[model samples]
Target: MPTSRPNILWISTHDINPHLGCYTGIWPGAEQASTPRLDALAADGLLFEQAFAAAPVCGPSRSAIITGCFPPAIGTMHMRTRATPPPEVRLLPEYFRAAGYWTGNTAFTDFQVDVPEPMYDELGDHTHWRLRDDPEQPFFMAFHSLITHESQIYLSDEEFAARTPDAQRVQKADVPPYHPDTEVYRTSWRRYLELISQMDHWVGTILDQLEEDGLADNTIVVFWSDHGLGMPRGKRWATELGFREPLIVRWPERIAPGSTYAEPVALMDLAPTMLAMCGLDVPGHMHGEVILGPDGRVQGRSEYVVSARDRMGEAEDTSRSIRDRRFRYTRHLHPDRSPMGHTEYPDNLWTWKELRRLFAQEAQQQLAFGEPPSILTDLQRSIVAASKRAPEELYDVRNDPHEEHNLAGLPGYADVQERLDSALDTWLAEVGDLGTRPERDLLARWRPDGRRPRAAEPEVDNRDGLVALTGTTDGSTIGWTTDPPTADRRRWQLYTAPFTPSAPIWVKTWRLGHEPSADVPIAAPAR
Candidate 1:
């Protein structure tokens, strides 16, 4: 039981859409997805019907979530890059910890270009609040269930067959119209839903532990996904399928059970909202708004939620989009680059392979018939489109949820296009898209030499019975351990404040996206 502050548990799943039973008919046939635990959880919680991620992929989406700033604003937009966030960007956990909350991550999931220091008091595959030294202390815990990640879908067909049960397997998969209907594609979809079911089980395990420990009533449990499904035209695109995701929160003390909030919200809004809920001042630099908090809902649809799809691995490109209730507007900055089909990572999935296969076969037939074929959809060929057809797009989501028809140049919609287009422009001007600058230029600035920079040596002094440590480099932090070498603590404990050790302690210095300093010993206060 917590004394004053409420505990926060963030449950994040990777690469999924709102495909649970609680989201009934959000996607046709999603009711059959079989997530009993999540369904029950939502039944007793608040379900957000229109939540969108800032990015379509994990690294960028998670970056925005942890930083409370759009990745583009902080130079962490591109996927899996080595860019460092500017110093003074306080992470959400740091604020909680400063307020005397014990933060823990059951396993690591930050794929942002920048990493936070003093990340967690405890971290491991099985780490839990139960393992904390003090049970009464309120805690911020995160559990990322990776069973639903796209990589799992890359398993061999035989492995999927062996792992799946007949009852749970997808039959006649409700294939998205953009994708071709084929046995191979259906199998891949089947495997994905099965994985979601497995992820639901993981959720049950964590929630069960919380209740088992008598912390259920006071803890706020939030379940969300990094992005939408990993299929083609989904994870790497800026369409609704790629950006919209599920967000459900169960706060027994604060929430009205079985209620739903349908206003649009950006996933990044979560960081600032969590801070406000904990009674901390939200940093002004954060781009997200306080949509929900202790006081009550900050009602109204977000004017527009901006999203981005930047370079993923070797396939480099950029696209920006903005979505309001009924319209989605997008601009592709680099259509000449290779299509998402050529992206190295997701290309391994059978769905991607199916797109390429179906597109090529249809192309051969088109050449023979001397006419364009309707069999291969623009959505499917978008995987391997020689280049994007238009630099901009507009979709009326309420009318065409799948975004099959592009309304950018169509007649009689100039007001809608101009309004959204202006809103997106204003947002970019205010925040400044760092992603527009060439990635190589950013790399050179961060690393003049071929190597990553190292944190300056840490200096420590024992003055007036209080030991203090400082770092020369900006954004640097210290990690120290009182334990000896025989104990493999794996990593050192984060040094947030000066403390009198029982004896001497070892310390190392680290700066985000830079090498850590060498370990050195510091003595305790004199008796």
Candidate 2:
């Protein structure tokens, strides 16, 4: 008999904010990239209106979702792999592997955790899953699509021609107020839509393959983007457009059709949810919760979904946001950092790489009204660079869903600001956030590769026979014995992490660490 354990299929797209027809009204039935397959998935599953990414960018958010913890909490706060993981910190697939599930990650695993650690089976990109070593075992697989990625590489001449008319007709450009509006901008936008269309086709192919395998019914299929649309709102900051992502969970036997959840949910919550759906206990170290029903619909949104930022030196930002049906309140610990302080230049149009020089030329020295005389000053430049934002900005989402108005210092909206401020303060206190006050030096201390000792010889503990090596920085990568040393020079498995105050990392197993024969069990310290 076929087992009842739910097979998990998590599909993630890169740099896609909530621009789908069902999530944002701007693209509904529009000639611009239509997402019919995605829309159908939403209809069949529970659609989340306020689902947020763990971080604004991919590397951080991916690390958080995979581990079911915040990036900073796990020393993966930076955008890439920086440290060797502690042996005991389990991967999502590792937990499922314990439950007798065959785990395969086809597309992406940017978490940077040490490989050869025995968590998931990497099946590269073959599309055909039935041919695997174990066919009927329930599984967990993540497919990350690069089709909607920010690049001119995905755009073709035909697509460029198809969007040229709309490109020329954008009357005001409504260009995020932070970016430069140039012909280059319009061209990039035009090509971006083309890329989105391409993404839709790629998504359809994945769905078709799932059906072809005849495993669609029993599988719990979840489709979501890592973050927002690849525009100004895509890469950095904590604006509604940046963190909010499209989330669709489909399970025919579990979720009710055509259901929508308006409550806010963070990507951090996904890890715990997956674990719960599989009837496993969420680890005590995880910070997220499981809110989805067995049928793949949300029972309710989180009371509050908080996002924090600690970019590398460019800007040290910390923000706490709380959103209900009516209000979205954000308290910035370092309001000065705003989006303008970062070099990511998310404001550049989607395929801006094609016209990078042209956009740079047009954007030179352009300043906003009442900007400082010396616009080069860091503070002044930030303000001028992001003219749309204020030190304290508030928006009544009920009236202005696009967040175009600034009600922070306004006469009538003072009450709203006060109320929102109170909410932010309470949340900060609860989360142990010190506040938005800028601490530039503290930020410097948290830099990914700031200062660290070079890896020395592995020091074997004479008492326990286990070799211990320390990391130089938060995300530093180091290799060590898979288990306690026995006789000779065994190969090493890479591990990364920052020290956890609660439990120190300790090794429990050993293996012949040499290449190819790198199969071994390394028990990490229990969190």
Candidate 3:
């Protein structure tokens, strides 16, 4: 009998917002001439206007999407922090694999750890999809594109000038009010749109390939971004522009063409929705609800979406936000710290540098004139305020869509703030958010002694010029290094089979989520 399951293809992009032609009606000039392919995709698929990521940064947001749980709840909220989930906590792909689906992912896992062995039959570049053993078997695959990453904004001014001609450039008036209205800013926006156009072409190729392979009707195609645009006060902020994403889903078998869903949804919901569509049971541990099923209609209305911001690189801050239909409320745990506090990564961006340079120029002009030196635009003041956050922020998104005006302390909005605050509290409690605690406090909670859970010392056996290493932990893997244990140096080699030894070696053992065992030296065997 033919299988009833449909194939799944997830195409993810980096640091892009809902700037497509479909969303252009809402965000004017977002639709550049270069995005014909994406415009076509939106015309053919269901466009979700209110989809958001659980966190602003890539690693944490991806963790939430993959695991279907809030990153803070799983101790994976910090940027670049890799935490292996306990064996009991299965990932989204693992669930599908267990349900007899062939799963694969491109080289971009982006979760900051090894993809569990059971999660995918193949895990590599885009070509891995063609390497699946059985083409007829239902498959789930993810392909990630990096064309619109923040680093793309680093193009030289000459390059920007040469690449985007006047006719192709977005007008300076179209630049967001929060950003400076300068040639450099407009050039950056044009460059980003060009990259988006390039990304759309690649997406069209993949979709075309599916049709050529006769799998278009049997495949469910999803395209979205990890988070939002790679701009200052965008990528790392806990604002609408930071968390909102462009989500489009095309299932030829179920969904109607050109449908739009405005109810709030999140990247985390993708896992459960896919499972439900595949006729599998949703796991109890997942925090997201299924937003769509086999019927291809909106499953239910989601009233609110929660997002977070935490440590990024050397900078440290904590913020939580809740967005209901018309209002957005944010609470900053460390209101005293600057929102732009010394984050090296974002500081290097041309957008950010230009913003700072403009601010400095204005300040210097004021100082030269011997005035009070307080001549600053609302945008400039807002940027300054970002450095030092208010304890609470409430915005009527319908009226102040850019979130410029804070109404948390206003008289008439007390009830709105209180209601959202209560909802945020309930969510924090339910998710067990460790973001409320300091970094040291979180570390102490995870490990009472402030030390990692180390694996037991390995036993080394050497006989007849052969070396064999054994680990005491039941599921631990043995690794070896030729050098002694040092704070900065340790190259571990996974021990798979017995091998003849040429020199002395240090052996250790480790299991995921546990500290590696102390190094044990193994001497060379005598001839």
Off by over 4 Å in 1: 1-3, 27-29, 113-117, 161-167, 296-301, 484-487
Model 2: lDDT equals 0.58
Candidate 1 minimal-lDDT segment of 10 residues: 160-169
How do these models rank on lDDT, best leading?
1, 3, 2
Q: What is the per-residue lDDT of model 3 for residues 1-527, given as tens digits with 9 covering 90 to 100?
A: 12478888999999988887778765435655457777787788899978899998899999888878887777778887666454345567766776677778887887744443335767778444577778777888898877778887677867655543432344432677667678777877877777777677788888888888888887889998988788877888888888888899988748889999877898988888898888889887777889988767779846988889999988888999998878889999989887667778778777888877776776777777765544446755566453566889999877877777889999999999999999999988887887666777766655677665666988877778688778786656566767666637454455666887678788777654567677788777675
Candidate 1 C-alpha lDDT tens digits along 1-527 = 33478899999999998888898855544676879888989888888877899999888898889879888888778877766777756567777777788888866656564444466777768767887789999999988877888877778868755544432566656777777888777776878888888888778888999999999988889999999888887888777899989999888857778878766789999998898877788899999888777743544545789999888877778889999878899988876765563767677777888777777778787898887866677666765686656788899887887888889977788899999999999999998898889898888877889677888878887776577788878977777787665676644567778877777778888776788777777776678
Q: What is the TM-score of each candidate against the true structure?
A: 0.93, 0.71, 0.83
Q: Which candidate model has the greater lDDT, 2 or 3? A: 3
- Candidate 3 global lDDT: 0.77
Off by over 4 Å in 3: 1-3, 84-87, 157-173, 366-368, 372-376, 444-527
TM-score: model 1 vs. ground truth? 0.93
- Summing lDDT over every window of 10 consecutive residues in candidate 2, give the lowest-scoring window: 510-519
lDDT of 1 at 58: 86
